[model samples]
Target: MPTDLVLLNSRLLDPGTGGLLPQTALAAADGRIAALGDDRGIGALAGPGTTVVDLKGAVVVPGFTDGHLHPVSGAERTMGVDLSACKDLASVRAALDAARRSLRPGAWLRGWGLDPNAFGEQPVGFAAVGAVLDGVPAAIDLFDAHSMLASPRALELAGIDGPRRFAQASEIVCDADGRPTGLLLEDAACALVEAVAPVPTEGELLDRTAEVLRTMAAAGLTGGHAMDGMRLGFYAELEERGELALRFRIAPWCQPGADADAVAELVRLQGTGGALWQVAGVKLFMDGTIDNGTAWLERPDCHGESTHAFWPDPQRYTEVVGELHRAGVATATHAIGDAAVRHALDAVEKARTEGGREVRHRIEHIETVPDDTVARFARLGVTASMQPTHCCEFTRADHTDNWSRRLGEERASRAFRCRDLWEAGARVVIGSDWPIAPFPPLTVMAGARHRRPSDLSLPPHGPEQALTPLQALQAYTVNPAWTACEERQAGRLAVGFRADLTVLADNPLNVRDTELRDVPVRLTAVAGRVTHRAPDVS
Candidate 1:
């Protein structure tokens, strides 16, 4: 049988060499790479009706996978006012006001990706945004999704009128008089306000999901490990309707209170759906974000100490992780602080003791960790799931951002040790942490390699933590596939592997670090299907 699709005149990046493959053309048949040969050599295998694409000297590599991102939530967040670009509270209000003109009367005024540091010394509460919101009901998610600011009406809508303590580390900030200040921290607190927030219809959900995935495809992503599972059905519905462009592994969230019974239920539902979208793991929050005061740190910072874990009962959390491991399910913990990192590693070790080390568990957003804990990742065979763009987006090298201000220079210097993790023999995976940062893997890779904001004058935050180009490529490809347990089927250009390839306008390995981000994606193919093709691609 002749090849169904042919990609010609392109360079291929090989994992083994950490460089381009010798061949310049690839043949695909039955949704798998059938053969690889030099340019013009594989043309003989093309059928009369074969769809041949001329890459025109572009670089082709395995389609990038997002190791950690919340597509459902990210999409919903994009729909609201994108306050991520706003540099200050005044700028944020201006963007909100601009968006307000197009909204319906009495409609919920929502915003997302609001940078806490952008407010300078101002507290994240109604005092900073009440006048702008007027009488509108609004829930604005912080850039890290760790906290949010709401208006008075929005607070009323969520039925919160005073300070409250949650089982988790979430806090509904209040004044000395116990009056609600419209600042909600962590998921537990966010849930209180979001519980009564507007719910999108099934149709709206599908549309938004489609929009986000298409954008991801254009940005060269073929898969993602969706961190949240509340909308697994949205991805399922997409595949069912043939609109699902990116494959996903759903990790349903597992908060503190879940017991053995909940773990058992997740185990039962693990492989219910195969391939496109599978529930293979559970997400746990070991600690909260550093920008806020909830993160469980190793010791006291300038603002004093916050050494508590996000999970009220750390022992129970460890026990449940063991249960999940015994059931052959994976667990990904959102551990940002050093204490949280150590505690999560301890939990992984406990699970490994009982279930063995074959399961690929992970710790996400490892923003800050002790130097010693770096050895544990490789020792326990735990994957370090990180977002490079977080450093680029949130912190400055001078310890000026909210996160840096909280940790101080001592701990902040060791933040996001991607290079150290890889050097320590740990499998590291990178992602956009979308809606929190840019979703494009190109931008994410550049951030991983440079760790600087676009301004070259500004010193890069934790420059030593930056990853080499080849290592960053591994994180975006095979490393993530290994974590997803799909290394055998995807993440490579082997004949038996899925025909998932992303073609870039330039060789990523050879390009300048800054130029890499602007390298356009020429084509994106998933299993022999062209999900996206640049206008110039023929």
Candidate 2:
């Protein structure tokens, strides 16, 4: 077959063996690898119409895949002010005040990546920043997407005067006198203010989403499992315009109140998508986030919170899982706490036993599971989809961070056990649950190896749980392919695999863990299409 693209003079790294392939060049035809050999042999496969480039000895590997992410929602939420760099209350106030200045009078103020720990010993309510946003209607999403701090004006605009009930474990947190405290836990409560906030037009949002996906490709991500499917149309439109850079497998949310009909609709959504994206599974929430005190923990946090599941009735979640499993639909549930992880595993076990079948069910964010639950992941064939930076950036080694302090010492010590899960025979896939954390694939991989912020000199959190360099690489490539049941066709550099590749300035396996994130992405390609090529690459 005539080759469509060819790379010559490249060092091919086989992630499976964590070594360099003897071949110095490869060719792609019709969106799959066609041949591999020395420079002269592979170069000969490229005909007149083919595009051939000399990699100049760059290192190529299977393109990185974020096993889990939220590109569309992340772009939407973060299109506003970014408070991720704010380290203290004063910095946060300064950022918000600056953002407030940019907005027209009476315009809504929106920000994301607000770290609760910035308050130090103070409570994480809008009151902490109410003075700065006194007149502005603001909705600041905490570092965890599960909660937001709504300014008093924003709450009043949403007509949320006091506490309100929700089907899920959501809360419009109230104070001592039964007045709303401006802390909204979970989606239902946050939506109250978000609905009233300003929104971009459909065109604007689609443009931003396309831009975000391109950024991911530039960051060396060829694909991602989008944990939310709300933006299927956005992806479709991008695909239609030939702007979609990443292959996305979307799993739309099946919330707490979903009935049989809703479950059926989700099943029907499967296989519905454009060329580069598909609704292949359903997303469910076993629990919210720990930072917001909404996670379903075996024991309560220091604040007596995180004691309930996201679903009002736990058995109903199991029933839904069984129904979906019977219909051959995979599910990825957000299980952040120990109790939530246990229940999700139980639900999958029950579903498999009752249906007498197997679907590659996944549990997202197994943040603080115990010893027993770690073994069940492999036993039940559940994939642990975790974001390492969550532990790296959110918590501290000394147990001084809010997440650590809330869980006390014991539960906190088990934070992000990526290594233990992998060693227990479980298939662990790593990702950057973007918008919550940064989405750089190298940054995510560096976190798995270091177990601490790459830029910091702090002691590692649970150093025993750090993954090896090769293990971290596989988590983003081979492991995600195994989780998606595409191992036979992708996640490797062999011929017949999809022509998805990333060319780095240096071999990731050969670089220091701390230096990994700095390795320049020379080129990124998906399905033989060059999605990103650094200017120096030829």
lDDT of 1 by residue, 1-538 (tens): 6677899988888864677788999998887899999867788889897889988899889888999999987787777788888888789889888887877988987788888887789877778864778888888888887888888888888889887778887788898999988888888888887888887777987898898899999999988988988877787788888788987888888888886677777788787664467887989988887877888888866677467899999898899888888878889998989998999999889888877656888999899887799989999989999998888878888888888888988888888999999999999999988878888998898899999875454678888888988888889998998888888988888887888889999878888887788899999987777889999889
Candidate 1 regions off by >4 Å? 39-41, 455-457
Worst 10 residues of 1 by lDDT: 453-462
User: Positional deviation of 487 in candidate 2, in angstroms?
Assistant: 0.6
Candidate 2 collision pairs: none
lDDT of 2: 0.92
Per-residue lDDT, model 2, residue 466, is: 90
lDDT for model 1 comes to 0.85
Q: Pick the candidate with the highest lDDT.
A: 2
**Candidate 2 lDDT score at position 359:** 94
lDDT of 2 by residue, 265-321 (tens): 999999999767889989999998888899999999999999999999999999999
lDDT of each: 0.85, 0.92
**Model 1 misses residue 140 by how many Å?**
0.7
